[model samples]
Target: MIEAGKKIILFDGVCNLCNNAINFVIKRDKNDVFRYASLQSEIGKKLIAERNIDISKIDSILLIDPKIAYYHKSTAALQISKQLSGIYPLLSVFLVVPQSLRDWVYDIIAKNRYKWFGKKESCMIPTPELKALFIDQ
Candidate 1:
């Protein structure tokens, strides 16, 4: 389980796009507000099961704000963006759009992510320096 104040990011392990996004977040995580876990990992699975998240319906990015709540799909991405440094937080302005519309777009990209971006044979192994950023690496 995550600590009370920290946020958790659950991502697809083998998806190249997901790994790249993790790297991007790590670079901009100036205050280290996030920790990560692949959806296939033990903690990831336990969290999902506790929340009763149906993978068939929503299997991609998920953000858990420990005691607060969990966010999925475009909301998760935009919420994450709001936590990053630089111009990225501006992306949360898109939240004014309807969630259904935003999720529609997110779904399209998620569905085709593997076909468009490909996948790795296994989950990324965090380097020693980054190991602390991941819970179940």
Candidate 2:
């Protein structure tokens, strides 16, 4: 089980847009407030099962804050943006919009992600220095 107080981000492993987003998060997250796992990994599977979240309904970003709350889709993105450095924090303003509208935009991009950005056949192997940010299988 993941430790309480830590925030975990579960993402699509092979999606290019997702990969780039992960890299963007890592670069801007100077405080290191996040850990990551590809949704296809063993750790990811276990976490999803343990949390009792329905996998069929979860294809976008997932933010798991143990013993607190979890968020998905546009909510997850906005929440993460609030923690990032620079003008990214400005994105929090969009939270005022209704969730349905926000998620509609997210879904459009997610549905065409592979076609627009391509995908890898397998998950990314993090560099040695960055490996500690990921949970073990």
Candidate 3:
């Protein structure tokens, strides 16, 4: 079941870069504010359909604030950063740049992520200790 106050992060399951980013967030998430699901999961697909997101256009990351809002690409990255512990919140300052420009850079990284970071044979399987942090694992 989805928790009441946690934001949900949907990510590319097989992408090593995305997996690393999620681990980074988990380490810095002092407030326990996020849950995760792979974009290939049933819940992830359901959320995407509910939001009417075009997966062909946004294949990297997504942040869903439940009933409130959803953010994708650089905006989603920045939003997630703001809640993280330490100086990471400052990264949100990049929001001042236009979304198109920010997403352009993000696209470059996303496009090469598989080639640069490699791909998993399948979606990540959270360890028993971290299982609660994931949904539909």
CA lDDT of each prediction against the hidden true structure: 0.92, 0.88, 0.95
User: Clash pairs of candidate 2?
Assistant: none
Weakest 10 consecutive residues of candidate 1 by summed lDDT:
1-10
**Candidate 1 deviates by what RMSD?**
1.0
Task: For candidate 3, write residues 1-137 as lDDT tens digits.
Answer: 68999999999999999999999999999999999999999999998998999999999999999778899999999999999999999999999999999999999999999999999999999989899999867
Which residue pairs come into collision in candidate 1? Answer: none
Give each prediction's root-mean-square deviation over alpha carbons. 1.0, 1.4, 0.7
Pitting candidate 1 against candidate 3, the one with the higher lDDT is 3
Candidate 2's TM-score: 0.94
Tell me which of candidates 1 and 2 scores higher on lDDT. 1
Model 1, 19-134: lDDT tens digits are: 99999999998988999999999999998999988978877899999777799999999999999999999999999999999999999999999999999998999999999889
lDDT of 2: 0.88
Better of 1 and 2 by TM-score: 1
Candidate 3: residue 98 Cα off by (Å): 0.6
Off by over 4 Å in 1: none
Candidate 2, residue 116: how far the Cα is off, in Å: 0.4
Q: In angstroms, what RMSD does candidate 3 have relative to the true structure?
A: 0.7
